[model samples]
Target: MGSRITSPEDAAARTAPPMRSQITAPVAKMALSSRIVGRGDASFDGAVNIRVETSGLTTPPIVTGKVPAVGSMITEGKALLEITGRPVIGLAGVLPMYRTLTPGSKGPDVLQLEQTLDRLGLDPGTVDDEYDTDTSRAVERLYEKAGYDAPEPDGRLTQAVDAAKAQVDTARNRLRQARAQLDAAKDANVRDTSVQQGAVDDAEENLVDAQEADGEAKFKASTPLPVSEIAYVKTLPRRVDEVKVERGGTVDGVVMSASGASLVVTLKVDAQTAQRLKAGMAATLDLGEGTPIAAKVRRITKNGNQYDVVVAPNRLTPSQLALLRDANVRVTIPVRSTSGKVLAVPVAALSSGSDGGSRVEVLRNGEADLVPVIVGLSADGFAQVAPKGNAELSEGEQVVVGR
Candidate 1:
């Protein structure tokens, strides 16, 4: 039956604009988008600027070899370069290798070394600070594995050398006693006696034995390498950032630069933002031209009012890393994120109701129905919401965005 608008109010209501218009498009019945995002400005310092320096050495060392390839990521327990013909192993540590370490040496440096070796599968016996025999053996194995020779003051050979010296001392004592007896007989005017003559002969033979023993003891193989010859770092598995010297070049201090195992992206933040950062927190790195790379918070350092946070990439191919080095890039971090996708609508479509609760004018079958919804986070002009009552709303349903 055709109905007529009997009153002006009815006519005005019927003739008024269909609260909103709808257009058909080849789109989804249900769509999801980000509800919250965090943005920040990041000045790319490029890849780590590495100027390889010689691990502390007292004297200038000649670079006998450049063991690691340039731009190579040096993993844990590896050498960065050969200093004075010996590889200066790079380990992760804050303390510098101060003194020359030998067998029986005890200190923080030895513990650092043993820990690095053990982590690399070298098994330096116990991880104690003492550079004992086991540590020496492990160090040798490490050197051999790296295709280099272990430095001197090695724990393995020191004991053998000490024992040899002790034998020489005993031989010398025997020779001294025999010589004293011969001298006494000669002084007593027994020059005509065969016994005195025999004593003299025995003394001469003992002296010869002692001399030979001393010569053999001193000739025993020993390492003249000083503790200073080895370079120590605090951590392991670092990447070779730069190579400063080539083979035959003098390592007068600088050798090469290396970064820790994880490539870090350093950024500064205000106190408010710094509070949000934590180790292992996730972030996004945008280099402007390419897709954003994923990263995690590695560390944060606070110095006075300035706070610096370090970030690391979850994974990056060699080519990707090559392209990113020193490249000016931007990074974005999401301060808050939802566990999963949620229903969201334009904030403009939301309006107040008599009860002061939030509601959206939903369009259904050419009619306007107001449905109450609970509001959550609002970002990018969209607010996360859920049906407040029995009112039903589904994804892709038409809702009035504006008057």
Candidate 2:
């Protein structure tokens, strides 16, 4: 047998067993957080049916034109329809216009009308319960924008006002004539001046009566808001769901039905998840179109063990609204999240340190080094980590996830 000479490297290679593959992963930059997902259906909120019925018309109110189309968005001060050659304007208010608003009309409904006018930038002077000339002017502007004239006080009232003015003039003329007769009697040194003075007194009394009648008639003839000319809706910018009346149809009850313009997703989740959600919290909605839509928490209601979560989506395009309307969607809300990108590692790589703190085994020069770390949010099988004390960890550094 011959003796074999071997170098140190060869001897070491022969003594060492076949190397086994080690399982390791690199540190990554990512956001870590826990998320709550729930299935929900999209729907519109605050639905309302619109009705425009006119009274006191000699002829039936035929919808001549300007009928709003279904799916159209009706905003404040917008015309809903043209009835009897006049526009029926829509205004936002909770109170229905039950009666014609005249100069003396005073109530909560009047205040609502004034406020709606102010919101529309029509400047209804002061918003108050009493309807005044400013409100009437605002109403006129509203009608003007709709390409029509505002409803005026009845012609009969106007004629009465004119008649009252004529009476006032006649009474004044009679008082002047009575005074002239009294002066003539004084000039003639008449013994019985009582008759002339009595005539003057009677004329004065008649004049007072005439003045009172004139004031009353003028007040009755001020600009008036006819209930038939306006429609009150609880919400503005409402989506027209259905149009019950056509152009040539007669104006009747329930001309249209509408709802809130924006769409919301309603979801039911467990109490635990519901507790983590809050109104105005950011969320994402998946419509199964590969693109997620932005949304926010609108409200939450509890019923027994289940809670209802309402999520309001950001402004969606018309096409997007069409796609989401009455469709099932996935809602994801993150209760906790990292502020931004941070150092992270697989949850499997984390282990209990000697002092019960968290630690990761970093591979350096074929040796394992225990680096103490503070664990942050853990999500998706990963945890945000920060090295403790003088220990250092960085991205792309290999960490032992498993043997």
Candidate 3:
């Protein structure tokens, strides 16, 4: 038996329309008889096929009906709503802050300045850029001495800028003087072979002397050796006899026809990056089998392609030395570490974008924020990202890895 309706009046009447029927429009009816040739029943699919055939399907209409609404509700015949939020979209980059170099910067700042100046071919006295009397005097003296045209005052070599300008002038003058000497020697009497030869030889010698002096000065100015190394080598000359007791103890200080083959691995680095891997630097050599051979940079060779860094073990056991001689041992050159924290970032997430710069996407609030970053020293797969102004960053921030 069918369930009974509670209302007595309702039981007599027919079932009312559904509540949803008031809000929903009636769906257009599809008649099966239309395909079978029935009257008053239109066929949209047939119409579409006919239109497509007539148009050749190559050129379609640019404009069409509006896309279906995503979310809509009716209050009366019409309703109104406001879009209250919007998403901001752009790429972000990470950049570094340019360091300020001025007087009164102490400790690391001074040391950095000193190192930088040293790298730039200027000595900032004792590898310490403090504005002491000695440093000021040395700098001023260097600037003045760097040129001959610049006046060399006996007492006060204090101002750096003036000294630098003076030094350049002096160098120019010396070069001019050397050129004049060479020219005068060329015009000397050639008929008197003996005298002329002697004069020419003298001029040539003078020029060579001046050039050697200049070259030596330039080298000294440009390449300041490490203080510790300099101190270490003070006791020994360029040639030192190594008495390896384990290699059978310096018998007669004789060369026993010692023949050993050194394995050479060549890695390429840019000119700027090559400066850090200078000769005599203590670098670690990773020989396979979980063992590392402590090595010193033997020499840096310049070829057409890139720097060929020759590394020799500072201390090698007989077995390890034999392995090194084998020439098939895989070696990894680890770049030396700096004293303290340098600005650094992940290597993968950086991209060189359209502006011809490295860029990284910073994730803020789950969205990509692009920032242009200045970079420095990249090693161990991590690069140093410089800070810009006061807007520094901390570790573990969500940096966008990719699109």
Off by over 4 Å in 3: 1-276, 301-308, 334-338, 341-343, 351-359
Q: Rank the candidates by TM-score, best first.
A: 2, 1, 3
Reference-based lDDT, each prediction: 0.65, 0.88, 0.39
- Angstrom error of the Cα, residue 185, model 2: value is 2.6
Best by lDDT: 2
Per-residue lDDT of 288 in model 3: 54
Please give, for residues 251-347, the per-residue lDDT of candidate 3 as tens digits. Answer: 1211111111233333445465566667766655554555766656566767666655555666667776555543433334445444466545567
- For TM-score, the strongest prediction is 2
Alpha carbon lDDT at 371, candidate 1: 87
**Backbone clashes counted, model 2:** 0
Winner on lDDT between 1 and 2 is: 2
* lDDT (Cα, tens digit) per residue for candidate 1, span 218-319: 433332325444555444455666676778777555455665555556777778778766787777777666778898777788968978777777888887
Instruction: Give candidate 3's whole-model lDDT.
Output: 0.39
What's every prediction's RMSD, in angstroms? 9.3, 7.4, 37.8
Error of 1 at 83 (Å): 3.6
